[model samples]
Target chain A: MEYLSMLPGPTNVPNRVMRAMLAPIINHRSDDFVELYTDVVDKTQQVFQTKNDIVALSASGTGAVEASVINIVKKGDKIIIPVNGEFSGRLAELIEAQGAHVVKLQTPPGQNATFDQVKEAFDNNKDVKAFYVVHNETSTGTMVNYLDRISDLTSRNDSMYIVDSVSILGGVNLPVDKWNIDVCMTGAQKAIAAPPGISPISVSPKAKKYMIANPPPTMYFNLARYFKYYEESKHTPFTPALPLLYAYREALSIMLEEGLEHVFKRHKVCSDALYSSLSAIGLTPFAKQEDRSISIIALNYLDGLEDKIFRDTLADKFKVLVAGGFGNLKGKVFRVGCMGEVNKYHVMRTVSAISSTLAMMGYKTDAQAGLKTAEEKLKAL
Target chain B: MEYLSMLPGPTNVPNRVMRAMLAPIINHRSDDFVELYTDVVDKTQQVFQTKNDIVALSASGTGAVEASVINIVKKGDKIIIPVNGEFSGRLAELIEAQGAHVVKLQTPPGQNATFDQVKEAFDNNKDVKAFYVVHNETSTGTMVNYLDRISDLTSRNDSMYIVDSVSILGGVNLPVDKWNIDVCMTGAQKAIAAPPGISPISVSPKAKKYMIANPPPTMYFNLARYFKYYEESKHTPFTPALPLLYAYREALSIMLEEGLEHVFKRHKVCSDALYSSLSAIGLTPFAKQEDRSISIIALNYLDGLEDKIFRDTLADKFKVLVAGGFGNLKGKVFRVGCMGEVNKYHVMRTVSAISSTLAMMGYKTDAQAGLKTAEEKLKAL
Candidate 1:
């Protein structure tokens, strides 16, 4: 089967990036390698949209999140987190693991935490050291206005703002510097158009101050040592995934050449086309229309249709892989990602495939009309 | 200039494996992925020569080593470790980080702890929970007779025998069952012919018993969880690196088809050829002859000749990478790896490159003669 990965992670990797990852592994100590590492770091700062100290760790996204927690929050620190989606809830668990107290601002599954709620929590808890939130929740297709609300909350309290932009980073217009985000970190798999191995983290000076003041006595995720090593030697504390770094350098080059604004615009257009097609097929979106993420669009199945059957038909027949609604909404919706290299053509094909698959699975829908409407919307762009 | 990476790891990745690794990013949950991971694990067991529970991790070698330490050793366990080379010392450090006390049996560099020494240490330390040692110390090019020693140590002591085979697995024969090695683990980059990311680890029933009795409180590196997941679902605790696992499957297929015995003999031939050429060129092998590893050859340079300059000449002129010594042996010795996919032909080419580069630097050797001797040695096979 000709399979296309429309899943949230391990997204469509570019051919050039694939080749770059395949390139011969070079000696890490070589001068050529140091130059490569330095170039990647500089380019990463541009992608992150921040002048903060960006350190690349050869770990999964979860590892970087753990590093953020371990570096800034020592034992018994009070941290504020949200329990909106899976990733946010994961942060709460990580905070708990660090032996820290967590004050969770709970919102409904599809809804995001409001600034007023966050403010109330902050006002109630003066000992909070940091605020952790996900900018775009992958489990739900809700895009929080992190820069507008969370930044205000953290700035008012003088606490560190740690944002996980993992699924939305490269595809969204996240001006990290303009937003005053203290710690913005991302994984490579989602909008980065690369393999899932490395995590890119940009630490604000304020966050760095907090990290240095309370450096975790850990070894693998030692942020202070990582900063020293990257700044002084352009290397990591241990042997990194060298091939993945090469892949990142290539992926970043392509991303920068396309410009961040163009990438963001593309994601919005593709996602809009997908949403339009779903609407044409009489399917409602899971999240509020205004808060739908540009990179991922979640479509709720009609009353009689099952999401698993719809997804299985798409995968087994059309070979278009997409994300199933996670957790509470498990069989209710399917998510189609328009991030990274996913463009208008892909969006149209996905819409057509879903429409046809739904029809084959005994759901009433004019499959061609969904595809035609999607194409028209995309062409009007 | 030709360059050689002789420093322990990020060892030379073969072009075939690198090309294999250049595949498109794959979805970890896909059924196609199940086949890849199963193949990788099955082949890894073949390399370890055991039917133990083998699991692959999407982290560096140290990360897996950390997994071993945290999985087996709880907070108050005592470990008996051989502190001969840098890697074994690292094992002790990892164990100590778990709040365990290490009883070290120290041996000098270029030497291995004798069986009597290990047994005596275990005999003296009645509370020892585990005994850790590196089968091949890449830092010192010293290969121990761990197989002959581990069986007696663990069979009677009721203690785990954990072998760090990071630099030696697949390059040498590791009979885990015959050797009674409770746990044997290795990384991808060393002699596995794959780029580094995943660490392959196999554990025996005895090690499983220890884990069941004392489970580490950590969630990430939980071995029992991994075993449950693999035994029941044939999956990992978290999302595994699909691409690296694919590379491992292919590399292992090649290794097995080539025959393990043939592969070991080839490594011996390459190592001996390189060692002979170094001797002919008036350089001394760093490791004692009786205990020298057949995978990596460490050579001492002539007095007053900086090892970096010689390494630079090799890299710049020949496009070959040799390793420079680390820590105490820096600037004094160069390491030439004969491990993994490296064969006699590669050794001949490297030896010729070394002799030619040295001759140009006025080191007085017939480059063509050294090349001829190395070629003759290979032709004899």
Candidate 2:
């Protein structure tokens, strides 16, 4: 059975990308594959808006996070991480796993880190050599808007500014070069509209030099090794996921065709329509409008309904797959992904499905009203 | 124009697997995804012929190699690595990168290590805690035939045994339990016939305990952490490459339906036919009879023809992709892989392409005679 993927990642891939992905495999070291690899890297750099070298690894986005930490941070080096949601929480765990000291500036669930909190943490931790922050928190649908300020703070102190834009890379306003992101990373499956298994990471010379001085106890996800291999030959150290690379190249082409600014505007429209439609059905977004994500929307259905029951009913009965809350936000919220190739119609279908499911479950929801609101919003956009 | 992939690992994926891979993405944390993940792991264990639990990582096979070394071998632990081919040489490098003491028992580029050499290395290295070997060296087309005997030697010496079956997993005969292999790893892009990006690893209880006792300085490739996640949640700690997993499940289903022994037999037939046909076209197999790969064949066109010229002509004119050698064997040998989802027709096409390219290069080659030999050999099989 087919289901509409509305999760924060692994969203519905377009047929164009699927056809490219199913193309016959090519030898990775072949000239044809070098063209594909180099094109993808160049396109990725454009999307990242940086002159920093981009290295694609056959790994998940978390693997890229591990690569950034293990490569740049020396052992026992203190890194200030702003914890806002599930993904940001995982950053702490990943840093600790790599034997680095993590100074976490905690924020409430479904909220972004305030400037005061971030500045206070920076002032308190003078030994911090790096600042890692999640640009888009996938769990609670929050996006940090103070990243440029944070980058300025890090640069003034001569520290690295690393950003995790896994969920909002192509769908939101993230200018890596403008913000001077020393290291920024994203996964292909999230906002790139490609199948997963490929992580595209950008590394400036500062991060590269730090990595050369303090190498990680890693070989596969070693950023410098990837850089060396790319510099020598436009190929990964190992045989990469060739099919996925095909899909990634095609997806990036699609995004570029639409243009990044227009893509971000479309996502904002989709997110706004979803909010209006969901509110028509008595469901409210979890995060504030300023900190809310254009890539995803987290909704609260608090009329004596369990989060699993709501999401499971929507998935099994309506064939719409949304994600349940994770970590500390479990049972409080459910997320709908609006990234990738999702259009207004996709968001409309999700909103319609949710309204129908709520009505079926005896919750107070007007399916027709929700559909009308969504259609009007889409038409206005 | 479409090309026939003849690389060592990124081989030709079957149409069935491709169609499955093009299926829409799903929520990875959903029950449907869990079913898919667990079934793939089970089938992987069966293909490995071991009851050990399978840990599938959404990374390249190199990530699995890093996991085996960093997780199982402690810092400063001595490991006995016999470097013969490019892959085995890479094993030594990976071990050394993890701060392990590598005792290299080196062999010639195109030769397999003898039993005496392997035994003498273990006998001399008293502090060796592990012995890692590549079952099928993809570069020189050498398969380690004396693995069971080597397993016995390692067991008697109280050291762990790890095998890398990256180039020849499902198409070759590898009895992990019967050979007492502590940790055996294979990539999805090899004989498994799936798209690249997933590494399936089978680990015994002994290796698990050792890893739990001494955790590696890793987060992404940490086996015990993966084990714990699998034990509790039956999911990867990070977002996996979902489409590749779908492709992997379908490919494993195809292999199981064909039966492992029949699969192995078919590979042997194809390899034999390719070897005979290439010989008819004035190419000599690189390795000895017993050590030659049943899944891949490396040939030396030893009439002073540049490797690049031959491979490039074949690829450009006939649209057939072959591999140039790596490490010390570079520019001396070319390789053709006849693993997973490959048949006699594929072999015939490859052999014909090589002969035609040689003929185009003003070399002595009997194109019709090679085709005739390949047909006769295939008919006999």
Candidate 3:
């Protein structure tokens, strides 16, 4: 049985993107593959909104995030990472694993790191080599709203500004160049609406120069090799997931064809619909209104509702798959992803499914009210 | 136009395997995903012929090779690697990049590392932490023939035995358990016949214990995280390339369905056919007869035949894509891979294409004779 994927990511891939994987595999070093790779890099740069060099690594989003850290920061260097959600905590761990000193700017779950919090950390740790932040916290359904401001602080301090925009970039209007984000990485499976496995990362000239001078002790995730191969022959240093790349290119094409502004607007409208509709059905939005993510909707379970039973019922009975919160938020909240091809029909069906499921579980829910709210919000799209 | 892929890697994916990727994306943490991941791991073990735990990484073959090195060999640890061709040379580089002292067992191209060469290195480097070797060198189409013997040496020395069987695993018989291989990694695109990207790596208990005791500095390629996730949740530590995992499982299913013995025999027969037929058409096999690989057939270029012109004609006119030699072998030899769903038709067609392309380039070649030789060898299968 096919179920709608409402998780933060691996979001729903379109038929056009999925069908693109069926193309026969080609030699990665051949001219045909070079053309394909070049086209993908070109399209990827447009989506990233940066003139920086872009490379698609055959890895998950986490791999690219790790690459961003290891490629620039040395063993003894100090780096500041803000921690709020599970993904942000992971970012800290990744930096710590590199033997670098990570000054984590701690924030409460459900709240994003404030500009003041980042400024204090940077002031305390004066010799920071880099400042890494998760643009969208998938676990808490929150986003760092002041990234443009944070970039300015990093630029003034001469620290590399790295962003993990895995689940948000395509859904949100993130102009990497305009924000002065030195390094930003996103997954193909998220808002890109491609299959997972390929992470498209954009590296600014500053970051590239640093990496070349102090090369990371890595072979596969080596960004220098990627740049060399891209410059010499438009190809990846190692064999890439060919089918996934094809799907990624097709997904990017679809996003471009629809226009970035329109896609971002669609994500905002759909997510806004989810927030209002779910709220009308007696579910509380977990994150604060100002910090809530536009890509994922985090909603609290009704009183006395079991996490597993609720998610299982929504999946088994209603054929809708959402995700439970991570770490401390596990039993408290469930996340519904509203990115990557999410439309009015998807929002309506998901709202209807959740309300009906709640009603079946003996909860007092106004299903019609929720559907009406969703319809009202979606009409704006 | 659909061309027959005869390259060493990114081999032609079977239709059944390709169709497996068309399944809609599911929640990776769901029971459905767990079952899928568990099934793929189980089938992967069967192909590996080991009771060791297998982890499918969302990386290419090179990434897995890097994992094998970084996970086991620590900084300042002494390691020995046999460098005969491009891949084994890379193995040495990966080990050295970890701040480990590498004692290279140098062997000439087109020649497999002799058992004596490995033994000498082990004797010279008494405190070696690991012994790494490439089972199949894709660049030169040569393979280490005495892996079982080397495994005995590694066992006696109490050093980790790591093998990069990327280009030859499924088509050749190198039982992981029987040979006591501590860590063995292979790619999906080679003998496995799946699309490139996912690498299946098997880890023995010994290797796992050492890794847990002294963890690697890397995060993305961390095997401990993979073990914890697999044991507790039957899932990967991070979001995997879901479609590629599906393709890998289907490819494993196909390989097991064909039976390992039958698959190995098919590979041997096909390579033998290519060797004999190409020789009959006046081409010399690059590797020595005893050390020649059963998966890839490397042959020297005919005199006065331009490398680019010859390969382009073969690809454009005959619609058969093979690979040219790498590094020093470039423009000197060409390679034809005979693995992963490579049957009578592919062999006969490749042989015919090479001969015809040679004849078109004003070199004397017997196209009919090459086809006849391939037909005779294929009749045995």
Against the unseen true structure, what C-alpha lDDT does each candidate score? 0.78, 0.85, 0.90
For model 3 chain A, give the 10-residue run with minimal summed lDDT. A147-156
Residue-level lDDT of model 1, residues B1-381, one tens digit each, is 324454456666656676777666666655667777788788888888999988787777777787788788767788888877777877787788778888888888888778888878878987778888888887778888656667676667778888888887888778888888888788888877777888888889878867767665445566887888777657675656666777767778888899999888887777778877778767788888778987778888887777778888888888778888866877877888787777766787788788888887887876666776687777645
Q: After aligning candidate 1 to the native by TM-score, how far in Å is the CA of B350 from where it should be? A: 1.7
Q: State the lDDT of candidate 1 residue by residue for A1-381, as single tens digits.
A: 456877877788888888887666777767878988889899999998889998887777777777777787666888888787877877787778778888988877778877778889989987678888888888888888646566776777878888888888998888889888888888887898878888889999888877777665346666877787777777776777888888888999999999888888887777878888888887888887666777778778788787667777898899899877776878888777777888876787788788788778777887777787788878745
lDDT of 2 by residue, B259-341 (tens): 99889888888888999989987889998877898877988866689998888888889988888988777888888888888
Off by over 4 Å in 2: A366-380, B366-376
Supply DockQ values for each candidate: 0.48, 0.72, 0.86
Task: Give the per-residue lDDT of model 3 (tens digit) for B1-381.
Answer: 699999998899999999999988988988989889989988998999999999899999999998898789888988888888888888888788888988887878888767888898887776788888899999999988898887767766778899999999999899999999999999999999999999989999999998888777668899998999898999898999999999999999999999999999999899889999999888999998889999988999877777899899999999999899898899999999988999988998888888888888888788888888889888989
* Highest TM-score against the true fold, candidate: 3
lDDT of 2 by residue, A53-145 (tens): 898878888888888877877768889998977789888887887678888888787788788888888888776899999989999999888
Candidate 2, after superposition: displacement of residue B136 in Å? Answer: 1.4
Best by DockQ: 3
User: Which portions of model 1 show Cα errors greater than 4 Å?
Assistant: A209-218, A327-329, A366-369, A376-380, B1-8, B209-220, B366-380
Off by over 4 Å in 3: none
True contacts kept of 2: 0.86
lDDT of 3 by residue, A17-113 (tens): 9999998899998998988898999999999999999989999999998888788777788998889888899888878887788888888888977
- Name the weakest run of 10 consecutive residues (lDDT summed) in model 2 chain B: B22-31
User: Could you give the interface RMSD of each candidate, to one decimal?
Assistant: 2.2, 1.6, 0.9
